[model samples]
Target chain A: MEALLAISIGVLVAAAVYLMLARHVLRFIFGLVLISNAANLTIFTAGRLTEGMPPLIELGQVAPDPGVANALPQALVLTAIVIGFGLFAFALILMFRAYTTLGTLDSDEMRIAEPREDDA
Target chain B: MSWLLTIPLVLPFLTAVAAFLTRESDWGRKVSVIGNVVFLGAAVLLFSHVYDKGVIAGQMGGWPAPFGITLVADYLSAVMVVITAITALAVSVYALSDINTRKEYLGYHALFNILIGGVTGAFITGDLFNLYVWFEVMLISSFGLLVLGGSKAQIDGGVKYVTINLVSTILFLSGVGLLYGMTGTLNLADLALTVPALENQGLVTVVAMMFMVAFGVKAAVFPLFFWLPASYHTPAFSVSAVFAGLLTKVGVYALIRMFTLVFDQDIGFTHTVLLWVAALTMVTGVLGAAAQNDMRKILSFHIVSQIGYMIMGLALYTPLALVGAVFYLVHHIVVKANLFLIAGVAERIAGSTDLGKIGGMYKTAPFLGILFLIPAFSLAGFPPLSGFWAKYVLVAAALEDQAWIIAGVALLVGLLTIYSMTKIWAEAFWKAHPEGTDPTLATLTAAERRNLLLPIGGMAVLTLIIGFFPQPFVSFAETASMQLLDPSPYIETVLGEAAQ
Candidate 1:
């Protein structure tokens, strides 16, 4: 299970990197989203996968050493996911505005904003 | 005592919400002023308490470390918090009249306050994940503030700035994830303990490199710095000044903290890379500054060059070098912010930031010229100024390590730094304005002059105070450096001895 999760994360990271290298502005935003999700999975896998374990609490009942899952990584990942969502929304809006104003989504075409010698 | 940490972080956020709600009233301005004053008092109180009682840690939601978020304030964090508070107060006051001219002044203030809270939080937070969250807070607010005035130039600059930072955030988050996977912990103190025992040294190096790249992008080091010169000069004076002073330093601070604590074992791998990068950053940054003719653009490029000095101290990794990095960080924050504020005043009087279009300002605004001169000289590492002491310690450290090449590069960078400052002085101050220049440009209104002078005076006085009384600041930096070097005290305090 751990191996599978790790491999999945690796693939996700590769896909995210590929998306990031694209020139389209929207693709760049999607790349960020994919990268963050891949990161979340990586953090989750770091805790060493365990099965049949409930959320880190113990109840009064007979159970076979109810090896609870690691709660710390879960908490951290949860916070990161929320923050990543906020970043995604921000990027989406910014890209939309860029598209409307620049009349193109190509990152290369955005070079008009580059510093010109005459600008100084 | 730990509760004092909440004041700097919470007040600005509360003020921001209040400002947004009361967006149309003078009451918003009053609230901002009151909030900043309270924040200044809190910072002073926090500094005193930390001086008496070492580092302070606060666990949020009543849960101890490993479960809840922790805010830790040591000498380093406290000093930075104090700087943030004082600088924010001065900039806020200056923005009172300056920001009102724009349609989105209230929104700008909201974003500005949030950015301050984020920077202060980043300095104080002990949790690694929490640090990233605070960075996003700073980044998002800065994005809004950078484009607040809504000019075509601003929107253009904002696009590049926002995209690059977003990419950096992704890289940083990915690094954090990989690190958590390897160590099964998110707390920095916990990582400090666990990272050393990890088996795969190669993976640790990779993670460390990722952090370097992410922070390098923010710190504007070498190859990753192109976005800064491209964008920093497009914003309004107040926005550009604060960003110029504080934003890049946060990145340098992260690099210092991580390299000292988490990646200490990867020294052979990472330190060498850092040394080469620092040298390249300095040379290239100076060359970029030399090519710029605009006052702000020149200063903006100089920021990247100065960051090389701070990174050099870190790469040297001596106690003295760490102290120098801390001192340089403080001095650069004040001097750089003051220079940008001077640029604002110059632009106000001359109607342009371009050096060719701006001349003879010293004839009319002599105080402004004097204000610009102090920091420019200090930034060039002139004697009897704060920058000189910082460079002296850093150079001494490099010599102690027998890193002569790095030392020579640093001295050469200092010379180039002086040249750039002289160019600004001669072009903007000593040279005569051309005939037929607008007469109105020569006159400064009473309110405008006050707005310009107040912040510059505040920073100039700070530069002088730190220069004259270097012992206390040096002692504070020494203590902070000690905390960073042996983070055993930090880890034990946060996680208790049992966890370790």
Candidate 2:
């Protein structure tokens, strides 16, 4: 199961890299979303898969059963997903604002901050 | 005992709440400044606690080591938190005049305080995951600060800055996951205990490189620093000054912490790679600055170049070298931030930051010229200034290592740094204004002058004190370096008896 998840992560990352290389800023945001999801999966698989077992402790038990899944990575992935979502949401709004004001999505054409010196 | 650690971490959040509540009134800015003054007091108390004690650790909710989250401070973290407060206080006072009411109404003070909180958390966090949380806190607030005005240039710069930093953030998260999988613990103290004992040491090196790249982007080192120059000049002067001084150094601090504490097993490979990156970063950064004409852009690129010296000190991995890195970190924060503040003043009086358009400051505003010279000359490594002592220690350490080539690169970079400073001096200060404007300090109102020059002069005084009296600061850095080189105290403090 871990091996399969690893291969899928590689595929997702490949797609992310391709999309992020585009000049359009929206594509970069989409690429970041894809890549962050891939990172989440990497963390999930790295925790050593325990199929179908919950991490919760049984009633009157000292701890969760030995075969239960590791809960730490789940907690970490959940935190990461939330943070990544906040960043991408902000990035999306920023892109929309850039598009309206700068009038183009192409990163190359966004030169108001660092204008070409020769033109000046 | 833990209150010493908790006060500095918690005070900023409380201040942010107050500032946000009072954002519409004049009381908002005053509250921000007053809160920072109190925050600095808390930081000094923390520093004194660490100075008297050794490495100090406190676990939240009373959970024991390697389980509950931990907050720890040694000399390095203590000094960094103190400096973060100092810079925060300086910038908040400057913001009294530089930030407009529209921006204050937009919660600028709130975001600024939160950013300081995040930087403090990063310095004191003992858990890897908690550190990631702090990075996100810092990143999100900075995103707001950078684009608060929503001007054309700000949004343009914000997009690039947001995109690049997000990528670096993901890389850092993935590295934590991989390292956790190997060691099964996210506590840095625990990782230090387990990383060397791991069976697959080679895989540990791979994770180390991932962290290096992640933090290299944050530190704004070579090949990964384009985002900085692309965006840094777009923000308010106060925003840019704090970012210039504190942000990248957080990256360097993380590099110093993780490399020395958790990733020391393969120094032969990791440190060598860092050495090459340091050299290239210095050369490329200085060259990049040479091509720039704006004052802020020139100063931004120098941030990258000076980072090379700090990284060089770390790469050499000697006691004296680490001492140099620590000293360089503190001195650079004051000098670099002051230079940006001076640039703001010049922009206000001269009506532009463009070197070609603005001049006559030397003739019209000689006091401003003198202020500029203190930080600029110090930045160029002139004698009896902070930068000279910083460079002197690093070069001396390099010579001691007998690493002739890196040492030569270090000196050449210093000479080129002087060239850039001189370029700014000749164009902006010595030359006549192309538009024939006087650009004198008298143009500013009395209140504006007080609000602006106070921080600039205060930091310049700090630079001079560090320069003229280097003995105490150098010894502090020496002890900090010793703690870094030998982390037994840190581990024992964090993990308690189990570590022993």
Tell me what TM-score chain B of candidate 2 gets against the true chain B.
Answer: 0.99
In candidate 1, stretches whose alpha carbon ends up further than 4 angstroms from where it belongs are A56-58, A61-66, A111-113, A118-120, B101-106, B438-442, B497-500
Model 1: lDDT of residue B494: 77
| Per-prediction share of native contacts kept | 0.45, 0.75
Model 2 interface DockQ: 0.87
Task: Candidate 2: list runs displaced more than 4 Å.
Answer: none
lDDT of 2 by residue, B1-500 (tens): 88999999999999999999999999999999999999999999999999999889999999887999999999999999999999999999999999999999999999999999999999999999999999999999999999999999999899889999999999999999999898899999999999999999999999999999999999999889999999999999999999999999999999999999999999999999999999999999899999999999999999999999999999999999999999999999999999999999999999989998899899999998898899898988999999899999999999999988899999999999999999999999999999987898888899999999999999999999999999999999999999999999999999987677
Q: What is the C-alpha lDDT of each candidate?
A: 0.84, 0.94
lDDT (C-alpha) at residue A13 in model 1: 79
Return the top candidate by DockQ: 2
Identify the candidate with maximal TM-score. Answer: 2
Q: What DockQ does each candidate score versus the true complex, computed on alpha carbons? A: 0.52, 0.87
